[model samples]
Every structure is written in structure tokens, then in C-alpha cells.
Target: MTNDFRILLKEDMRNDETGERWFQDIEIGSVFFFSVQASTLHDSTPPALLDDVMAYEAFQVTLQIRHGVYNFGKRGAWQHLEDKPWWPLFEAESPVLTVAANLPVATVQQVYEDLVACEKAHPEMTTKKCLRSLSVC
Candidate 1:
């Protein structure tokens, strides 16, 4: 790998599910930071501190995304994204996404116009871009 990969997207493990909580589709040269943490409850009562406990902290600094799968060890934990392509690494179902801030509002109208033109030029492409709230690529 030539040391260039940027994080296209990432999600933290906010709920219980095994494995690391990071994903990316970066260019050939980029740098990013991922702050990872793990915790467990102790004693099931007040004063949640105890000696028999496990704790982990790390800065997954500067991951380089080459064209193949790479697995870094996390205390023998199983990674959900193992052996999967970048897109499939995303959960099977789409998350309930809030409107992304960077998608320029005006671009929607422009894209619609382009789609219309494309359909006119090639009648086979006349499918609707919006079908049941999912954008058709």
C-alpha cells in the first residue's frame, strides 16, 4: 500500500454488537483518527468501580486502506466487517439517516433535470430517481 486512505464514513458502536465500529473508503493518501473504548459494568450496584474489571483505550491512528481486507487485532474480539467489501460492511439495512449537511439543496433539482435529460436521450433510462424514499442510483 502506498499510504493513502481517507475515511468516507464511520459509525461508533453505540449499542451492543460484537466487533470494531469503524468503516471507510478513502483515497490512496489520507490520515484519520478513531478513538475506541470498551467498558463493562461491575457489581450491579452503586460504586461502579471494582478491581475485577476490563478496560481498553486506543487511538486507531492513520489507517491505510489498500485494495484488500485488513484485520487488526482487538483483544481477540470478532470483527463484524471481516472479509466483506466496503459497501457490504455497512449494515444490511439502511440506517435512519438525518439529512446530511453537505448535500447541497440545489443539487437535488439539478440532478432531477439531468436525470430527465438522460431519460430523454436514452429512453431505457427513464426510471424514476425516487422510488419509495430510496434514491435510485
Candidate 2:
């Protein structure tokens, strides 16, 4: 993640510019690495420890754990509030790709291929090819 992203919560589940609650300015195909922070919502009525709470689900959210390049377009078209309730950058898909949390691979490539394709549908991606290098060590 390049730390160049923001999380916006939309009001209506459906796509309606006037009805949406929040909107994030992001490139259409750009991919982002994001994770919902575990949260605890507590209630105090009988002086109990707590009641209400929110937590991160196991595998409920998929993280590609890769870097993405920038493109042009609305972030709303690529992301939905239903899939990622806590924040933006959450997509319904499998995050393009994913790897083990233990950093199984030292480097990853084509993190931006999807975004690039979405930006401009061309055969160059498959023919010429674009690659990205990541450092795990």
C-alpha cells in the first residue's frame, strides 16, 4: 500500500450519487491494501463489563497483500459498502490475489495489472506485460 487512499462509507447500498452517504476519491482500477481494525462497542446499563462489540472476522475479509498502481475513475464503481462495512478499499472479489500472512513470498508482481486493465482494456498487459517487485526480506 502506498498510503494514498481513504475510506468512505456510503449511505445507500445501491449506487445513487444523491443517495450515497460518503464517497472516496480513488482511481477506478487502483488496488489498495486495507484491514478493518478490531473494535469493541461497549454498553453500560447495569454496570456490567460490556455488551455490544465489533470484531474482525476470520477470512470474512480477503487481503491481497500486494501493491497497486494508480489509475483514473471513481472508487464507488469498484467497491461496495456491503462487502466492506468498516472501511473503503474493501471489495467483494478475492482482492485480485492473496498470500499467507507469514509473508510466504518475498516479492509479488502484476499488482496493478487488474487496475491497468480496468483503466484501458488492451492486449498489452498479456503481451508486453507489467511487473512489480516487493521486498519481504
Candidate 3:
């Protein structure tokens, strides 16, 4: 078996029917694990000392996703992102989100799918540049 693979999306969310937390990793296939804290973006992080954000939905991501990510890690204030093609690992549902970031899982899934489509179509631009250049939409 190969030692490396790409992760398209992952979710450690609560099971609606059983009220139990579940773990899901989506790559070419799915892997499962158990999590006690389902809705949390970071189980280990203390609540962020944001100026105004009361709560948010967050994810663990690769550093290449955003320009400031590596510098942010250098500050040694939080955990560093993963090192791989997953380089830009975390993405906000949007630039700014509010209230549990309470989007449906299907919607969140679609956002990642759209990101892949964007990457495929642009080939040379980062996701940010693609969306920014397409500013008409």
C-alpha cells in the first residue's frame, strides 16, 4: 500500500440519529474513527482570543492554502499545519462565518467539490486567485 494519499474532505461530526460523534475521512475511499468532540474545529486549542468572534467553525489544513499560514505557525502561537500536498489544509467555509458556521454537511461538501473544480479549471492559480480573478461572479 502507498504511504501517502490525498484527502479531499473530512468530517468529525455528530451522528444525527444516534447523537454520537463520528469521524469520516474522504479520499478515494472513506476511513472512520471516533471523536468525543464532534463540532469542534480543534479539540486541543483553547477558544481563540479573537477580538469579536464568539465562536466559529474551523479546520486543520495545509499551510499553502493561505499566504500567512506559515508565518502564523512561526509565531508559535498555535499548531502548525500538515506538511504534504495537503499543504493548504484548512479553509473557512467563507472568509467570514458566524454562529456555529452552521452550514449543512452537504453544503460544506459542495464547497470542497467546487474548490476542486476551480483548481482543475485554472491549473496554475491558487484557489484564492482563481476566485478573485473571477470577481465578476
Candidate 4:
């Protein structure tokens, strides 16, 4: 038995002006989200936390995404908040792909492959605009 998880594409949106794309995936009743945006001059957040962050000039895959939640007593039954347990599978510059924690290496590779395929199928939606720099490592 394996605890590996997979993400199914639920929605995809892009901002033509900024070249920023958002992806939402369904997994275990929650949405796994990520984005790819064009690089910019005043990027406050370093793409990768490292001594030489510039080396990762190709792109940046930030593990930062809002976690979906269901609040039974709230007016809105569901909300996406910044507090989520999904951790980065690897550093910013790593060519190796990863998702949430505790997943096997093979599972991470599979997820990366799936994402690449999706990007290839939707070339226009992948990176057409260039507003700000963001990436999927």
C-alpha cells in the first residue's frame, strides 16, 4: 500500500496582461493550487531561498498557496486561507518535482509529469503574458 496522492485539474485561469496563470486541482476533497507568472524587476520574495538565488533564473516554483477549508458555523461554508500543511517537496532550484509531504519520490515525479503534459496541451495558457515572474519548479 502507498500513501501517495494525485491532483486532478479542476480549473485553470490566466491573466493575459501579466502572463500569470493559476491552476487548481482536486485531491482528497481539497484544492491543490499553484501558479506560473512572468519574472519582474522588483521581486521582493526571492524565488529560491539560497545564497545565489539568481541561478534559478529559469523559473520559480513557490509552494505558497491557499488551503481550502470548510467551516460549518461560518456564513460562507468554505474558504481558502493561507494556513495549509502542504510543504514544499524541494527547494526552488531543484529540477526534481514534488508535491505535499511524505509522498514517495516516484509519486512526485508522476505529478510533475502530469503538470508538464497539461502545460504542453495548453501552450497559450501556460506563459503568454509577462506581468510578474512566477514559476513552477
Clashes of each: 4, 1, 8, 6
lDDT of each: 0.23, 0.26, 0.29, 0.30
| Lowest lDDT block of 10, candidate 1 | 94-103
**Structural similarity to truth (TM-score) of each candidate:** 0.19, 0.20, 0.28, 0.25
TM-score of 1: 0.19
- Sorting all predicted structures by lDDT, with the top scorer first, yields 4, 3, 2, 1
Candidate 4 lDDT, 16-113, residue by residue in tens: 45534443543221222333221232122332222332232332233322222222223111122212222334343322222233333353434444
Please identify model 2 stretches exceeding 4 Å from their true place: 1-30, 41-68, 74-130
Model 3 regions more than 4 Å off: 1-37, 40-100, 126-137
lDDT tens per residue, model 3, 1-137: 22111132233454444433333533211111111122333331222322222232332222113321112233211122123233233343432111122333333334344434433443333233434544321
C-alpha displacement of 95 in model 1, angstroms? 18
For 74-128, candidate 2 gives per-residue lDDT tens digits of: 3322332224223343334543432222110111112222333334543222112
Tell me the deviation in Å of residue 66 in model 3.
Answer: 4.5
- Model 1 error, position 88 (Å): 19
Highest TM-score: which candidate? 3
Off by over 4 Å in 1: 1-101, 126-137
Those runs of model 4 whose alpha carbons end farther than 4 Å from true positions after fitting are 1-99, 131-137
lDDT of 4: 0.30
